[model samples]
Structures are given as structure tokens and as C-alpha cells.
Target: MKAFFRGLVRFLLKYYWLVILLTLASAGFSYPRMIHLFKTISTDPIDLLPQDYPSVQTLLKIRDKLKPKKSFGVVLESSDAEAIQRALYDLKARFERLPEVGRALVTKPGYAFFDKHKLLYLELEDLKEIRERVRRKIQQEKLGPLYISFDDEGDKELDFQDLEDKYRKRYGGDQTGSEFYVSPNGRIYAIYVESKKPNLNMAEERAFQDEIRKTAEGVDLKSYAPDMKLYFGGSTRVMEYRALVHDL
Candidate 1:
């Protein structure tokens, strides 16, 4: 063991300079490659998806046709549906004005769908005038299962209770609720937002999220509906959505 240690000490004394020179030369040779590797690295999870996967293929195709859209889901809380709806309308307008936002949908399919489907999501008195208009149209067009003709108005009952019950049974339990913009219980409102293209850079992605949150927070919910509370969700707000999509 002493002889081996003496030999090792003699070898190191002879080769220590050579070893140091080799290591410095190796580092110099690899410095550019190290820099390039870091330059190409991505923090975005979407970059990790396999190129052959169906979602990746679909995403690439979408990218070719249109810029990828980031979705933001807004949850608004208030007991006053009318005031909440009005506030949401104004909030949506404000969101649209932001350069980052592409589109904002406070109510699904707008007033046309609401006019015809009020009994599905809203209380009977929420849209009394529109309901009356829809009722008149139903009478004129003889819509629904019974298809009661205008002539049979006095003779046959035009009750929509069965239809309402069926709609509630079919859709009330779904996550978005039986209604388009409002929840079944009527205390929560949903907004679906589409944002402009996302930047692959981490700093830009952070900026995107901050812009979305700031825009939501800037809305004066108190002026329109004092009880309203705004909350943000969906892909842009939650990065985990990217992982979930990749798993799918």
C-alpha cells in the first residue's frame, strides 16, 4: 500500500499540469455548445408534447390556420342576476379593449338564445318581457312537443312545465350548469374568454397571465353589482392545464 501511494504521488507530480491543461481545453471547446443548449431550452410545457401525438398534430394544424388562443374562464358571484349580467357585459367590453384579448363571451350565444331559452336557466320573472315575446312566438309557430296551435290556445293548455323539467333533468348537473351564462343556482356567472397568441418565452407568458388578472381586477364590479366577485381560471390562468392536455 505504501509503495502504491508513492507511485501515485510520483504519477500525479508528473501529470498534474497535463490534467489541468486538458480540463481547461475541454471547457473552452464546450463553452459555445453549452451556451447554445441554454439558448434553445424552453420553459413552456407545450414544447414537451410529442410531435406525433394527436393533440400536438391538431395544435400544429390550428397554428397553421390561426394563432393559438389562450382561454380564460371568469367566475362572477352575485345574487342580483340583472346587475351581475350588466356588470359582466361592461367587464367583457373592457376585456375586449385590451390588446391581449381576442374575444370575450359573457353570455353564450347572446340574447337570441336567452330569449328562447329563459325557462331553462333563469327564474320566471327574470325576463318577463322577453318571455312574453317568446310565448307569443311559440303560439304563432306552435313550437315544442305539444305544438299547440294558435287557434287551440283557449281549448288546449300550453304549459311548458314538462319541457322545463326535462331540460333541468338533462343539464342541471353539468359543470357549466343548465343555463348558458348563469349557473343553475343563479349565484354564479361564467365567462369564456379567448386571448391573443401566446409567447413561448417564459417572461412573456408571465406577462400574459398578469395582464389577464389585472384586467379582471380592474373592473369596477362594485359600481355595477356591489356583491359581485371576479375570479379567473382556465388554461392561461392555470399552467397545469397544459400538462392535462398533454396527458390526454
Candidate 2:
């Protein structure tokens, strides 16, 4: 052990200067390129991933590294919930008209169980009052339709509850066709949104997504994803369509 130790130390000492000289030489030659590369990389402005979206980032990282995604937005106005739904119908027509959309289909495929924080099936006997009421709620509370659901195990649920409270406080009378109840036969609520269009532009596709999200207002969404009627599946086809066609 003593002999081995002495030899190792002597060997390192003997080669230390050569090692130092080589390192200096390499650094001198490579340092400029490395600096230039770093500077070029830093030319883009620093963008920090939003801290509040850890769970989303984690889930995505498991599939693919977190990539910066920007969503386009278009806000619409309506006097009340009925008007909003009506607007969605009109938008869908216009959306469908914007090019190759002859075969667009919209229907619930499979719904096992369903539930909502509150299901509203309102028939407005008097439209004026409801209009005024809706305007007040929207302007004062900044409210929109809220859909809440849950899957099995009942995990990640507080967001649904929060939206429920917000919806209740915001809307007023003359609303019917709404009830908040859980389906006794529920086991899974299909809890995912996809683009329905098999071929659509990205801008148009994303617009459809925003419109759907807006329309699902007052719809019940639970914590866990349940495979039930409450789970309205959004088509992912539209999302892929634009990207796919882009390559063509």
C-alpha cells in the first residue's frame, strides 16, 4: 500500500505540469467559439416557464419536455347563457364554413355517467330581464360558463368547486334546464378535449378549442376524469390537422 501510494503521487506530480499546459492550450483555442455560441444562444429574450403550471409541466415532461405553448383568444359577448349557447351555434356554422369542412360532425359518442356542479336548463319567459341580469353579471363579476367534472378517486377537485361558487354568485333568475347531480351509474367521465376537425388550419383549430371551452360554461367538471356523460370529449383531430397539412 505504501509503495503504491508513493508511486501514484509521484506519477501525478510528474505529469501535473503537462496536464496544466494542455488544458491551458485547449481552453485558449476553444474558449472563443464557446463564448460566441453562448452569446448567440442568449440573443433570444429569457422566458421563464410559468411557476403555477408545475403539474402540467410534469405530466408533459413525462411525455415530452415542456415546450412553450401560446394559445390564441377571441372573446364574445351575449346577454345571457342562452344567448351564449346560441352564439356558439352561430360560430360553429361560420367556423365550419371557413374551407374544407363538409364532413364536420358533432355528437356525444359514449357517455356512461354524468354530473355537473349545477345543470341549468332555463326557459326565459321574459328575455329583457334576463338580458339585463346577464349583462350585470358579466360586467360586474367577469363571469363566463363554467364546466366541472371529476373522474374516479376524486383527485384534484378544488378548482371545480371554486368555479361552482363563482358561477352561482354570478348568474340570476329565469334559468332552467340546469341541475347539479351525480349519475348513480358513473364509473368514468371521458375527461379530455380534442379537436373535431380532421383537417383544419391551426388558427381555426385553436379557435374551435377556445369556442368549445367557452361553450362548456356551467357544465360540471369533476376532479378525477370520469368516463361518463359529464365527460365531453373534445376532438384532437383538429389540432393535428393543421400541423399535418402544413407539411403537405
Candidate 3:
């Protein structure tokens, strides 16, 4: 039994190191390829959302890249009521003025993203009259779940739930359908709207310039630009989605 035990220990000691070395060698061989795969997976969203969207810099190039279908996103926000109203008017006017703008719509203000520097979030629900007006638009156009809407404020507006309740009672529950994000501070809110065209070469930077201008009409405004999640979800999710697409 002593001899057997000694042999067993010696065999285990000798084979254990060999097993470990093989495991490490295997991992080393796969690690570089795994890292390369990870990097490629991570960079796919940058493909879906070209880096130069807000500017018309890549418009002509992108128009060529997309032969028949071209889509673009517009995100805007305002702290000033007059600016917001002006923004609405400007957007409506621009939609009418631009012959190329086939799909014209606004997002729900409540479904927006704001910066983390904001101090207060006002309750911004439609007034009874305003709700009636929106209702009229919906009924008239038969726009059911078709429209995506947002407000000047995102979820943080609910921080003042009582005030929001008052606004809800005064206005109505369905503010807008568009969904968006609000920063931790009350300084910024973001809402996304989209446009489609057959060929928008050098996309009209002026397309929604009026709307953006309207949002800041006669008010002190700060700009932080915008970010969007159209192809999928977050950065991690995009990697997973790309892997799935690649696998298929």
C-alpha cells in the first residue's frame, strides 16, 4: 500500500504540471484570436451609426453607400418654453417647406434624455385643450401606435410626481410616443426623430435647422449634440447582436 501510494503521488505530481502547462499553452494560442474577435465585435455599432451623422460632412458619401434607402436621426432639446414652442412651429414649417422630407414627425417629450446638470424638472403634460388638439390629430390621421413621441424632460420629470399628476389631470396620460434618455443633471434632454429619402446626398443640414433654431428661440440655449441607439441596444448588446448576425 505504501509503495502504491508513493507511485500514485509521483504520477499525479508529474501529470498535474503537464496538464497545467497544456492548459496555459491552449489559452495562449486562443487568447489573441479571442481578443481580435472581441475588438471586431465591439466596433460594429460604429458601423451602423456612422461617426459623422450630425454634420452633412458624410452626406454625399453615405448617400452613395446606401443606394435606395437613406435614414437619418435628429435629436433636440430645450429648457425654455418659448423655445420649445418655437421649435414645434419651426419643425412644422420645415416639414411643410422641405419637399424632400417624406416622413415628418416629432418624438414624445417625456421620452427624452437630459443632462445631469439640470436643477428642476417641470411637469410638461398637454393641457386639456392641448390634449384635445393632439387627440384630434390622432383621430384625424388614424395614427395609432405609429408615432413615437417624447417630452423636453425624460423620466426625471417624474421626480416631481405630484406636479406631474396635476399636469396629467390637466393634460392627459399619453404625452408622446417617442422614447429618450435624460441625464442625471436637469441640464439636458434628448429626443430623436427620423427622416427617410431615396437619395439625400449631402443631406440637407438645413433640413431640421429651423426646428433646432425654434427650440432655442429667444432663449439662452446650450448645445451638447446627440447620441442614438437605432440598430440595437447598448454597446454590449451590439457586440452580441453582431456575433449573432455573423454566426447566421
Return the TM-score for candidate 2, rounded to 2 decimals. 0.21
Rank order (by lDDT, best first): 1, 3, 2
The most accurate candidate by lDDT is 1
Q: Write the per-residue lDDT of candidate 3 for residues 1-248, one digit (tens) a residue.
A: 99999999998887998878889999999999876654444333334576776644465566667654333333344444344434444444555454454543443443445323222343234344445544655554565456444644321212345544564466444332113233333223343333345532221323333343343343232322222111111123433645665774
Q: Record all residue pairs in model 1 with backbone atoms less than 3 Å apart, i.e. clashing.
A: none
The true-versus-predicted C-alpha distance at residue 115 of model 2, in Å, is 3.6
CA shift at 48, candidate 3, in angstroms? 15
Per-residue CA lDDT of model 2 for 125-175, tens digit only, reads 334445654555454444333522233422222233433444445653212
Model 2 stretches with alpha carbons more than 4 Å out = 1-60, 63-73, 96-113, 116-248
**TM-score of every model?**
0.53, 0.21, 0.25
Global fold similarity of model 3 (TM-score): 0.25
Lowest summed lDDT window (length 10), candidate 2: 174-183
Which structure is stronger by lDDT: 2 or 3? 3
The residue ranges of model 3 lying beyond 4 angstroms of the native Cα positions read: 1-10, 42-173, 176-248
Span of ten consecutive residues with least summed lDDT in model 3: 225-234
